[model samples]
Target: MSEKRPVMTWLTDMDGVLVREEDAIPGAAEFLRRLTESGCKFLVLTNNSIYTPRDLRARLAESGLDVPEENIWTSALATAQFLSDQRPRGSAYVVGEAGMTTALHEVGYVLTRSRPDYVVLGETRTYSFEAITTAIQLIVNGARFIATNPDSTGPSPAGPLPATGSVAALITRATGVEPYFVGKPNPLMMRNALNRIDAHSETTVMIGDRMDTDVVSGMEAGLRTVLVLTGSTTRDQVERFPYRPTRVVDSVADLVDDIVPPPPTESE
Candidate 1:
C-alpha cells in the first residue's frame, strides 16, 4: 500500500460513529476534542434532515458531546447548497421540517406550493398524505424533483419508520419522475462538504460506521475511509462488500491519538 498523506480535515457520520440511541459512544468526546485542539476542520454529518444544525448540536450536547452548530452538517444543508449552485435563488415546494425550510431560506430559495421550480423532499417526523399528493401533482405538472437523501427508513423507539427515500419512491410511482438524492452515498454530498471546509480530498479522512453509505461515498469522493464497527456495518460484514475502507477500527476512540498534535520543536 502507498503511504497516505497527513490528514488535514475530517468528515464523520453522527449516529453510529459518535452516538448510538441518543447516547454518546465511548471515546467520541475525546476524539472530537482532539480534533478541535489539533485545529483540523471537521463536520459531523447526518442524513436526517428533520432537525437543523442548532437542534442537532443541542441534541449532541445532551448526549455529552460538545459539537458546535457550525460543525454539524445535514443532508438539508447539502441539498440547499446543491440547489443554490444548480439555480441560484430558485424556488421549490418544500416538504420537510425547519431544517429543510431553514436551509433553503438561507440560500434565498422561496418555498411555495404553487408552480414551484422543484419539489424538494426531506425527512420529517410526520408524512402528510396531503403534502405528498401535492408533490405528486406538482411533478406531474412539470416541476423538477429533488430529495435530501435516499435513506429508506429512519430509526425510532417504536421501530424503523419511513424516510425521505420511501416517500420519494411513492411520489415517483405517482408522477413517474425520480427525485435526485443529495446525501451520503452520493459523492456530491461529500464534494459539497469538502468545499464547505476548503479541504482537499487527498489530505482528508472520512470516518463512518456504514459501509454502503459512508465508506463508499468517501472512497468515491477521493478521501480515505475508516469504518467504525459501532453502528450499521460490522467486522464480518466488511468482506461482503466488493470494495473496502482504508481502515477499520472499533470506534472513534481508536483514532483520537492519531490526530493529536505533535509536540513543539526545541527551536520554538
Candidate 2:
C-alpha cells in the first residue's frame, strides 16, 4: 500500500470559516494567530472575486482579522491569470466590479464597452438587464465566455443573496453557451494557490464549508480536505452527499488547535 501523505500547508475558505459576512466567526482571529505562531503556512482561498487581494485584506482587517495581502488569493486573480495564459490579449467585456476588471487589466487584457475578445462574469451587485444583454451580445459575436466562480448565492448576515452563478446562468440561458468556470471545484484556483505557496497536493489541505466546491476541488487536486460547518454547508448536507472530507471541524479554530500544540517539553 502507498503511504499516506501528511498535510503541511492549509488553504482555507473565507466566508464561513473565518467570518460570516462582515462579522468574524467565533475565534477566527485567534485561530489564525495560533496557526501563524506555529509556523504553519496558510493561504486564505476565497471564491469571491469582487475584491482584489489587497481589498480583501482591508476588509478582513476591518473585521478584526489582520490578514496580509500576499496571503490572500481570490478567484479573480486566478481567472485573470488563466485567461492571460490561455487567450490572446484583447478587449474583454467584464460583468464585474473594479477588482475583477483591474486584475484583467493588470494581466494586459483591455476592457471594452462593446464587442470584445471575451466575456467574463463575476459577482456584481449591479447586475442589470443591460449588463446581461451586453455579455450575451459579446458571446453571440464569438467572444469567449468565462466566469470567476459558479456560486449561485453569496452569504450575508441575513442569508444568502444572488451572486455570480445566477448572473452566469442568465447569460447562459440567453446565449445558449455555458461560461467556463475558474473558481472553487475547478483546478485553476487551487493550482494558483499551490504554486504561490510552493506546495503540492500531497502536502496541502483545503479547508472550507462547501463540500461540492472546496472538498471536491481538493480531492481532485489530490489534497486533503477539511470541512467546517461555519458556512453554506451543514452536517445534514454532508450526510446526504456522496463526497466526504478527510476531516470536519466547527471552525478554523478547531483546525488550528488540532494541527498546532500548545508547547513542548524536554523531558521524555
Candidate 3:
C-alpha cells in the first residue's frame, strides 16, 4: 500500500455530513470546531444551488455549526465561476432562485430573457412553467444550456422534489440541447473548489455522505474520500458501486477526533 500523506486540508459536504434537514448531525459541531482550532484549511461543499454561502452559513449556525460564509461553497457559485471563466460578462436567462441569480450577478452576468448567451438552470422550491418555457425557447434559438448541478431531485419536508436536472431534461427533450452541468460528480466542481481555498488535492481529504457525488468527485480530483451513512448513500449501497471510499463510518460523529492534529512528543 502507498504511504498515506498527512491530511492538511479538509473538504466536506454540508447536508447529511453536518446537518440533516434543519438538524445538526451528532459530532458535526465538534468536528468543525476541531478543524477550525487546528488551523486546517477547510470548506463545506454542497450541490444544492438554492442558497448562497451567506444564507447557508446562517442556516448552519441555526443547526449549531459555526461555519463562515467563505467556508461554504455551493454549486451556484461554481456555475457562476465557470461562466465567468468561459465567457466573461455573459448574459443568461436563469430559471432558478436568488442564490443562482446572485452568483451570476457577482460575476458580472446579466440576467435577461431576450436572446441570452446561455440558459442557466438551478434548484428552486417553486418551478415556474413560464420560466422553463422561456429557457426551452431560448435554447432552441441557439442559446447555450447550462445547469448548476445534475441532481434530479432535492429533499423537501414532504419528500423529494424535482430539481434543476429534472427541468434540464425537459428542456433537452424540447430543444435537443444537453445542458452542461457544473457540479458533482463532475470533477470540475471539485477542482474549482480546491482552487477556491488554494488547497492542494494531495494533502486534502474529502468527507461526504454520497458515494455517487461526493466520493466519486473527490476520488476523481485526487483527494482521499470518506463516506458517511447520514445522507443519500448507505453502507449496503457502497458495495453496489464499483469504486469505494477510503473509509466508511456511521456518520460525521466518527470523524471528530481525526480533524485534531496529534500532539508533538518530547523529541527534543
Local error of candidate 2 at residue 81 (angstroms): 0.7
**Of candidates 3 and 1, the better by lDDT:** 1
- RMSD vs true structure, all candidates: 2.5, 4.1, 2.9
For residues 143-175, could you state the per-residue lDDT of candidate 1 as single tens digits? 999999999988878999999989999999988
* Candidate 3 Cα RMSD (Å): 2.9
Task: Give the clash count for each candidate.
Answer: 0, 0, 0
Clashes (candidate 3): 0
lDDT of 1 at 139: 92
Sliding window of 10 residues with minimal summed lDDT for model 2 = 256-265
The order of the candidates by TM-score, greatest first, is 1, 3, 2
Write down the TM-score for model 2.
0.91
lDDT of each: 0.92, 0.85, 0.91
lDDT of 1: 0.92
Better of 2 and 3 by lDDT: 3
TM-score of 1: 0.96
Residue lDDT tens for model 2, 183-211:
99897789889998888788778888899
List of clashing residue pairs for candidate 1 = none
